[model samples]
Target: MVEVRMRVNGAVRSLEVEPRVSLLDALRDHLGLTGTKKGCNQGACGACTVLVDGERINSCLALAVQYAGREVVTIEGVAADGQAHPLQEAFIRNDGFQCGYCTSGQICSAIGMLAEHRAGVPSAVTEHLAADVELSAAEIRERMSGNLCRCGAYNGIVESIQDVAS
Candidate 1:
């Protein structure tokens, strides 16, 4: 077992976890943060997305020990004082999800995507890499391509992210 310490949902957490344990499993099984789903354990699906130090990652592909001393933010940590994050509100307003299995991951991914864009990260669809990236539909789609919604909610998800971006 490896001892890992990280800040989760604004609290410092220290736990002994297997060196190979995924962050998703640690969050769900050990910390009881079940809001992050596990749709595909192989990381093809972004159902296990979470923020590590403000960047979105496929938690299923990341080891718990790899995030030691970092800030790990799961979907449960996205809200503020019981108020939903703007991206979450946007997702709700835009009806971005169905079946809800992918909602948490989608929202978390959108939040991280927006942050990346704000920091000038270029997406595949970005026309001008040197300039501030605009939140175009194509850009949003490209950035969120890693996340799949089996319910066919792409339009709504794109619209939600666009709404929050604007």
Candidate 2:
């Protein structure tokens, strides 16, 4: 087993894992951060989404060793001072979740999507190539396409993101 150290949430955490151990396993199994769920165990589902250096990625597809010394943020880290992050609040306020299985990934992906929008990253529906990217409903939908909600709470999910984006 190789030793990997990563800044999870806010503190540095060290654990031993095989080179092939997924970041999802390392977080949920090794570190006890179960908020990052394991769904599909493949890249197809965004249920294991998390942030690496402030960018969202599918944790199930990322090896733990590759993230050594990097900053990894899970759903547990999204809030500050024990208060729910604005997105989390918005999620509750907007009924963005159901079944609660995909909520964490949805929230994390939404946060990353917001960051991308603020940086003027364009999505598939973004029409104006030379202009500032607007966070239209279509753009939000396109950008968050990776995360699938089995409960079909997509309308609320989109609304939650829109609430925060605006």
Quality of model 1 by C-alpha lDDT:
0.90
**Model 2 residue 14 CA deviation in Å:** 0.6
The CA lDDT at 11 in model 1 is 99
For model 1, where is the 10-residue window of minimal lDDT? 127-136
Q: Model 2 reaches what TM-score against the true structure?
A: 0.96
Q: 1-166, model 2: which lDDT tens digit per residue?
A: 9999999999999999999999999999999999998889988879999999989999999999999999999999999998999999999999998998999999999999888777767778877543344477888889999999999999999899888877
CA lDDT of each prediction against the hidden true structure: 0.90, 0.90
The residue pairs in collision within model 2 are none
Q: What is the TM-score of each candidate against the true structure?
A: 0.96, 0.96
Report the C-alpha displacement of residue 155, candidate 2, in angstroms.
0.3
